[model samples]
Target: MKAEEMWKASTGKGVKVAVVDTGVNPDTPSLKGQVLTDEVPKEVSYKATEDYDGHGTSMAELIAGTGADGTLRGLAPDAKIVPYRVALTGLDKAEMQKAPHLAKVIRAIADSDVKIINMSFGGKIDLPDVREAMKYAHDKGKLMFAGTGNDAMETEFTGFPAAYPYVVGVAASDESGVVGEFSQHGNYVDLAAPGLDVPTWCDKTFRSYCTGEGTSMASAIASASAALVWSAHPDWTANQVLASLIDTAGRDWARDDPSTYLGYGLIRPRKVLENKDFNPGPADTDPLAKENFRGVVDESGKPVAASPSPSTEPSKGTETSDGDDQGDRASATASETDTSGNTTLWVALGAAAAALVIGGGAFAVIRSRRGA
Candidate 1:
């Protein structure tokens, strides 16, 4: 994406991204001064800095980590992170009960100064409560991104939150720009980003970085990309920010006919940043209104045939001891029960070496190779 050239214009300085996941570790070498714990709402905030499985910390770092102490730098280093802890699949039963409800958490973030909400996790079942919370956030004009899930190897069920209206579903891709086989595909996919073979925290210890990949990481990058565009034009509404991304995204197919694997193609924030005269269209008009208002389709881009709830199986986080095979792994956050009483699976993004980053001056650096 040659993001470095675009960084000459914006570094996502004034933007604040809400990392809605397990929890964000503020003490990480790269995130030392980036996390804003005090800004979090007291009611919804519980162990907001305690990362249970390293997934939340990695997503936080991917968006705003400062890259201090030689740790991985985020795509928007100048931006700030607001951490929120919610119940996921792998959390203890007692601890999960203590965590705030997903609806409350989303509403709190919607009322906050956060302009972007990055949910690198997803669930299979559609929960009305969660959907309502997301709608509230959307009404407040917030840009949200979520992983489409990493269950491409298995079934093609739509990942919740991402499948919801107005929430952009992001898919994972490699340096070569090919979508990962694990990235879930459906009409809900709004955009794609580098997700394969990226650097992430090895575990909750936050001691060292390891290679990992999944739609989770891709969602973080997409959120950071929006931060860059929004930072450059702070007055732009959420619709405008998203419209700019869809307008400037890289793709080989026609804009109207988006790819199921890569919706609107790989994100290229630089294209929007470089064009000072870019028109972002209407503020209230949603860029994804058609998909949201009309109806959703299956992985083949056909209209929804059936809604199946996949059983919650603990997937391993993608970790590779060698640079060879990238297999299934644990998701960043555990699966949680939806309103349907079904256990929802959150895609586990582990380590891989896909090129997802390019330099953007000193402030805009994602953990990927220098070229697209």
Candidate 2:
């Protein structure tokens, strides 16, 4: 994605992204004047800016960090963040109990003016209340994104919130467009983004950025990508925004036979932004209608409906590569050059070293215990 060129069109200005994660530190050098603390509802705003682990702040910075004082530059630096904190692994037991419920936080965000909800976290359990909350947010027309998960080695369980219908589940990929082996794969993955070797806050201290990999980072990037598209086409509804992404995503395989590892393909918001006259289909028609309707279990643990799948013409004029054979591993290491001329770690290593070699353990515990 030629981010600089896309910036010539839109910097995600005037868009608000609701980050439903651990919390966001408003005082961070890059986040100053970016996080909307007061906009968070009073009832579920407890410790909204107190990030126990550095993960929440990292995700926040990935989406909207202003890149001040050598900090990470966000993909949507001009967007605003409405932070929310919920219980996760490593939090003190008492504190975790005191945090607002996840469903309530989701509901609050649904009722707010936030255009996007970025949940860079996941869990194996699919709680009905959480799914209902997600549905409520969807009904309210919010564009939601979540990590498919980082524990592809330990479990094949489809991560929830990500598996929930109407939510865009994102998987991790390298700069070369190779899906990370650590990225859990399933029919639920809707898109892919760069996740390997990304710089992240090492801990709660926020002292330095450490190399990390997981679907968490991928989800953040996807959300920011949507922000850029939404900012460029302010009149487009959530469906249209998502449809635009699906229309222009980089993929090698037929769109109807989406890869289980990379989803539709690596998200390339630049393609959508570059085309001023791009048609995004209908505002009410879901791009993933077939996948959402087929074989998906609802919060009530029941099948909704089996609808005839819609047809998609193969995308032309974009780069293409062979789809990964399920469970095949490969290797490469690369750095991403930011607008400031800084070389940050972009995931290194091919498929073989994708899971065990990358040190993404930090995200595993947090996501696994999201609602435990």
Candidate 3:
């Protein structure tokens, strides 16, 4: 992506992304003035600013970090962060009990003005309450993104919250647009983003940055990508913002037949930001309506009738590529000139990777990283 030129159009200003994770540290060098602690509801605000494991802070920084003190700079550098703390792994038993429930946290954020919800965590189990909350948020017009888990090579299990309808399941990818081996796959995967070799906070100490790799980083970047498009087109509904992303995403497969590993392909926000006259189609239309309505079941393993009639058309002002072979593991290229008179070539690689399994049940930060 032509990030520098893209910033010339929108820096994700006036947009707020809610990070539902362990916690977020507002005092970080890159996030000093970027976090909106007061925006989080008081009832679900326990330790919201106190990051116990540093995972939440890293995600928040990835979405809105200012790059202060040579720290990691977020894609939407001018976007604001609304932090929410929930009980994920690494928290003690007592702390877990005290932390607000994921369902409640999601409900609170849904009611608020936060445009995007970034969940950089996941687990194998799906809770009924959380699924209901996710539906409520979707109805409220909030664009939600979650990691597709890091256990693709271990098990065929799809992570909850990500598997839940209305949540865009993001998979991890490198700068070359190749999905990471650890990034989970399945019908739930919606998109891919740069997740490998990215810098993130090491721990709660906030002492240094570490090179991290996981779907967690990819989720945060996906949320930030939405922030950029939403900020540029403030009038666009959540559907429209998402539609634009789906329309412009880099892929060699048809929009309807998304790749199991990379979804509609890697996110290319610059494709939207660079073009001022981009059309996002109807506001009431959902780009992922077909996928969202399908594969979602209720408590009794019965399919839920979420929408009246899902549309077959993916989006407007977009065309399907002729690369029909989904199993073709070959790299493709697309090049263009930026507003700054610089040439940029995006390498869209085929998907292939390994996996690892984290503990099941309660939500755990989908962390896969190496210390710097």
Candidate 4:
């Protein structure tokens, strides 16, 4: 489905998406007017308009960009992007050696007013504090999605954030709908999308665009699709929105035979949106209530940590509250620092302006970009 059609109903105007990553740049043309920072908390040192690393900017563009300069286009063009600059890359070896600040940033996003949270970063270890924070967001009625990691050629290991219960784990697929060989496969994968030949920012400078091949872009797309639905039905609870997506996901296989690599299949929000009378299932039913489901009840009926594999680092600092801050992961942030190799684009962005509005209506569109 084209994004232009969805804009007719709603452009995600009232919906806010919180991106938690290195940072975002507010100058991008595609992201000019789509970002909102007023709701972000002040405690966080990051700005919602700056993007230090190009990774977050690219992800942002994929979710809500305006398609300026003939660059990447987003699914929810009118949605607002809230940036959060978490320390994922190392300032030095010591900074790199420290545990990622994902936990802090995620907790902050949940605490804020944003309804959608996108996290495109992952590592082998599962930070305990981060898991708790994710659960907190789920309880708060926030929709969260994360990358399933890209370590297939290496150790073929599993990673956290994606593996956490309540967090929608996304996988990478090629233009032909085939799962990429590099995309890690596991029971945690919840969905798949075009990630092999996606376009994005190459650096914080916003100089040029590049072709990206990973699950990060897929996660961003999934999150944006959610934004489209949430924006249309502002009264729907987070549980209802998520349940609708799960119920309408496209798959040729049996409902019980969820692919370890592809999860429920590619998301088709159109299926959910087309049927105005469609039911979103039970609001209390966890969309992931089957095997590999999260928020599981113990034999004693108490909520237990469902993490089969936990992060190596010890939990530190009490995250007393659940609120969102100005840290957008897949999109632009207020300016900051990034040392990762250039692989994204930076541009001058306006505030919430969208040129095209795709819809849940199926159309023969969705221009694929290759080798930017």
RMSD of each: 8.5, 10.8, 13.1, 9.8
Question: For candidate 2, what is the TM-score?
Answer: 0.81
Output the better candidate (2/4) by lDDT: 2
Better of 1 and 4 by TM-score: 1
State each model's CA lDDT, in order: 0.72, 0.70, 0.70, 0.63
Q: What tens digits encode model 2's per-residue C-alpha lDDT throughout 1-372?
A: 666667789889999999887789999887999999999999999999999877788888888877777677778889999999887655677887788988899999999999999887766665778888988998898999988765564445666667888889887766666666567767777887777667667778988766666777788888888999999999999999998888777776666667666677778788898889999889898787766777666799986732222112221111222221111111001111000000112221232321111111111111110110
Ranking of predictions according to TM-score: 1, 2, 3, 4
Model 3 agreement with the true structure over 259-314: per-residue lDDT tens digits? 66777877888889888999999999878877776666799997683421211222
lDDT of 1 by residue, 1-372 (tens): 565455678878999999988889998877888899999999999999898878788888777776665667677878999999887755788998889988899999999989999887777667778788998999998999988777666665777778888799887766656666667767777787777667777777766666766778888888989999999999999999999999878775667776666777778888898899999999888888766755567778875322323223322222312321111122223353211000001112223322234532211111111111
Best by TM-score: 1
Query: How well does model 1 score by local distance difference test?
Result: 0.72
- The superposed Cα distance between candidate 2 and the true structure at residue 88, in angstroms, equals 0.9
Q: Per the 3 Å backbone cut-off, how many clashing residue pairs does candidate 1 have?
A: 22
Clash number by candidate, in order:
22, 12, 3, 66
**After aligning candidate 3 to the native by TM-score, how far in Å is the CA of 271 from where it should be?**
0.3
**Candidate 3 has what TM-score?**
0.80
RMSD of 2: 10.8
